[model samples]
Target chain A: MVAQIVFIIILLGAVYLFGKNVAKVRRNILLGRDTDRSDRPAERWAIMTKVALGQTKMVKRPIAAVMHFFIYVGFVIINLEVLEIMIDGIFGSHRIFSKPLGSLYGLLIGGFEVLALLVLVSCVVFLARRNILKLKRFSGTEMTAWPKSDANYILTIEILLMTAFLTMNAADYKLQLLHFGHYATAGSFPISGFIAPLLPSGPGALAGIERGCWWFHIIGILAFLNYLPYSKHFHILLAFPNVYYSNLKPKGEFTDMASVTNEVKAMLDPSFVPEPAEVSRFGVKDVTDLTWKNLMEAYTCTECGRCTSVCPANITGKLLSPRKIMMDTRDRLVEVGNNIDKHGKDYTDDKTLLDNYITREELWACTTCNACTEACPVNINPLEIITEMRRYVVMEESQAPASLNNMFGNMENNGAPWKYSQADRLNWAASDKVD
Target chain B: MEQKIPTMAEMAAEGNEPEILFWVGCAGSFDERAQKITRNICKILHHVGISYAVLGTEESCTGDPAKRAGNEFLFQMQAMVNIEVLNGYNIKKIVTGCPHCFNTIRNEYPGLGGTYEVIHHTQLIQGLIDEGKLKAEGGESFKGRKITFHDPCYLGRGNNVYEAPRAALEILDTELVEMKRCKSNGLCCGAGGAQMFKEPEKGNKDINDERMLDVIETGASVIASGCPFCMTMLTDGVKHMEKEQEIKVLDIAEITVRANGL
Candidate 1:
């Protein structure tokens, strides 16, 4: 009864904290400008199914895909065992489903055991890939101490949880063999049976080990759930919604600015009266100026660096790493969110996403090649943020590069990006043919 | 030799509309090297007997560079001016020799109310080959020489027109090769997003120099391109590496004209 009370208290505390963090994150994301992404429900659903649920893009790298497949499947399948553990914890019953389920319970637990082993092995390999092999993508400039440690911590936690689960079953299996009280012959432990021989052959020791593991597994999972909202691992939940609202237009299309359109219309027409509205900013200088979709994209970034690895500018040793763009956005957003939490919703920090986190060199180095967008597993568009920041720099601040200023001037006056006159447009046709 | 390319004004005066409007972009009009590509595009249209009219003085910038360079006000102004002229003519079909012009007019112009059937010149040549209007049988033979196609970011990943350009080249007698990063994975030529007009930001190496390594890896003697900007960058890349004698950077239309004897 005392154990059940403690379990209930811990579970509720974890749930409440997790709920608070989720609410904070949602509020942070909604702080951005409004844009409708509710159109074409059927198409969005199809894409969500293919990209997030099916993990189709993950398979682009076959080795990592296969390993990730193991971990993902294991995480899902092992949740069934977690359900059993939850019930057992609440009722203070040992394997309560054993009587009703009988043979089927053994089969299911046996399958979960196999998956737990795979999850354990995969996590170790992932850890080694990060720490041992030191994959270039994982050790990017943006992946400082905290991000790197966060990844290592998650992998280590998973490894420990899987170990506990298997060992718990092994201890339980031994207790059942001795026909101990409440330790009914329920689960068929194919893996734990191998481990059973190694454990101490004593009933009291076995019971303590089983109970200790049960508490550890449940508590670890609850802690992991709470950890997700504050970590890059938040992608596990956000990837679905992020991909559903993907920009389905042709990659070449840059969205026309309505503010610019209204201004241009008034300039072009003598009789036209522009709509009286709030003084609209040209583009995103900070998170608040960005669309909600862009904010959600920042939250959904996995920091996998698939984007940075394929970036043309980053490939040539340029300052523009697409992964870093997403990281900086998220970091700045988190800071803004913290400020809001402490100083109320209308708080201002005077620092923007531009100049503080992302540099001008990084912004200009981008070729606007959509490689980052194509390479993102969750369909996050870093180019959108880069372009929006560029717009703010040029239109709001009037700080465009000298060469680009020349090009704009020529386009304004000569009707082209050069000093040549529009009257000479037909000169190419009249010129002598090259042999 | 003068080619007498008819202007939209002349076509309208004759109470007729050409089959397509040849959008002579700024580079095609002014740049000395890009002018040769513009002439070949006109030659191909004339040889295939497809009636096309140039917008001539009426054509203005499509605002691709300005928009990309973060100057939205200038871009929209340029777009509106071009849209007004294009809508005034009621142009139904348009073709462009430059991928930047092709992409901007096709995708961006429609939102600004300048809708038309826009296609890159490579796609037009591919269609001609498909319909048996053009053949590579009679022109300069590249049978023994190795050729490779550099997918322009605008036309390939930007618009998903990867196959059309390759189809135009596949019709040739030359052996076609591929860079390791081709199609959707093609690297930028350090020329898009108004980067052509400006020097690149400080980096370990220029993007074109890095891309040239990919070209060199393929060991292709002839690099076929579809964008004027890409042509300039690749040609400069060849000079940068001093492989001008070993490698020739030719526009896809230029290659088409050489192969089809147009």
Candidate 2:
């Protein structure tokens, strides 16, 4: 009774805390401006299945894709074992499903054991890639200590949790072999059977070790669940919706500003009268000005740096890293969310996502090549945020670079970006240089 | 020879209408080097006997650079004015030499109520060759010369027209090569997103210089280009590397014209 009550308290506490964090994240994402992504249900479903569920995009880098496949599949299949553990924890029963499931229980547990071993091996390889190989994508200017540590910590925790699960199974198998109390010979331990011999033979010592491992495994999983919203690992949950809501149009099309359209209409025609304008800002000044889809995209970034690796500006040693852009957006958004929690919802912060986090140099360095968008496994569009900030810089403040200003002026006056008159528009046709 | 290229106004006034409208973009009109590409496109169109007319003085910038540079007001203004002129003529199909113009009119203009069938000149060339209107006959045989196609970001990834441009080259007898990054994974020639109008931000090397390394790796003697901005950047990159004598950066249309002896 005492053990079951303690398990119940811990389980409830973890659930409540995880629920609170998820709500906070949802609220923070909703803090941005509203835009509809509800259209094209059929297409969105197909894309979600292909990109998120099928992991099609992840296969672009075949080696990483194969390694990730093991971890992803293992995590999902092992969760079934977790369901059994949760039931066992609540009712203080040892392999309760064993009686009803009979022979099938052994097959299920045997499969999970094999997967646990694969997951363990994959984690070690991932750790070595980050620490020993020191891949360039993992060490960008924005990666700093915390982002690096976050990645390492998650991998380390998974290793510890997988260890606990296998050790618990091995101890249980040993107890069952001796036909100890309440320890039925139920599970077929293909992997744990090998480790059972390494354990001590005393029944009392084996029981204690099994109990300790069980508690540690379940508790570790609960802790990892809560850590997700705070870490880049949130993509495990957010990738589905993010890929589904990604821009469906051709990559070249930029969203037109409806407010700009109204203003231009009034200026062009004397008879045209526009509607009374609302308090509309030209473009994004902060997280609040961005669309909810854009904010969700920030939360979904995996920090994998695939986008950064393929980015033209970043590849050429420029200050613009698409991964860093997503990181900054997420950071600034969390700060804004915290500010709202401390103060009122309408409270203003002294800092913005513009000069305070992302600088003008980084924004201007982009070529808008859409490489980052194409490279993203989750279909996150960093170029959209970059262009939005550029709009705030130029349309709101009229502070575009001098060269761009010249090009704009030339387009307005000369019917082109150059200083030639429109009369010469047809001059190329008469030229004899047919090279 | 002074080519008699008829404007839409001239053709319309003569009680005749063209089957297609050739959008001679700003770079094609003003830039001295890009004009060579314009002439090559015209030679192919004229030789194929495709009835096309230019917009002439009525044509304006499609506002791609302005929108990309974050001046949406200027971009929309340019788009609206151009749409009106295009709508007035009841243009059903259009072709452009520049991907920037092609992208703006085909994709962005429709949202503002201007819609038409827009295609890049390379796609037009591919169609002409596919329909048996053009052929690689009597020109310099590039049988053994090494050539590679640089996928302009706007034309390749932006619009997903990779096969058309490659098809135009496949019909030639040249040993066509590919850069390390080509098609959807193509690297920019460092001239996109209004970066052409401004100096790049402080970096370890210029984007074109880095891209030139990819071009050099293919060991291609001739670099096939499509977009005007890419042509300028690649031509400059060849000069910067002092490989101007060994490598020639020619537009795809220019190559098609040479291949067909147009």
TM-score of chain A of each: 0.98, 0.98
Best by DockQ: 1
Worst 10 residues of 2 chain A by lDDT: A426-435
- DockQ of model 2, rounded to 2 decimals: 0.75
Per-residue alpha-carbon lDDT of model 2 for B15-69, expressed as tens digits? Answer: 8889999998999988998988888888888888889999988999999999888
| Candidate 1 TM-score, true structure as reference | 0.98
Candidate 1 clashes: the total is 0
Report iRMS values in order.
Answer: 1.3, 1.4
Error of 2 at A137 (Å): 0.5
lDDT of 1 at B186: 88
| Residue A82 displacement in candidate 1 (angstroms) | 1.5
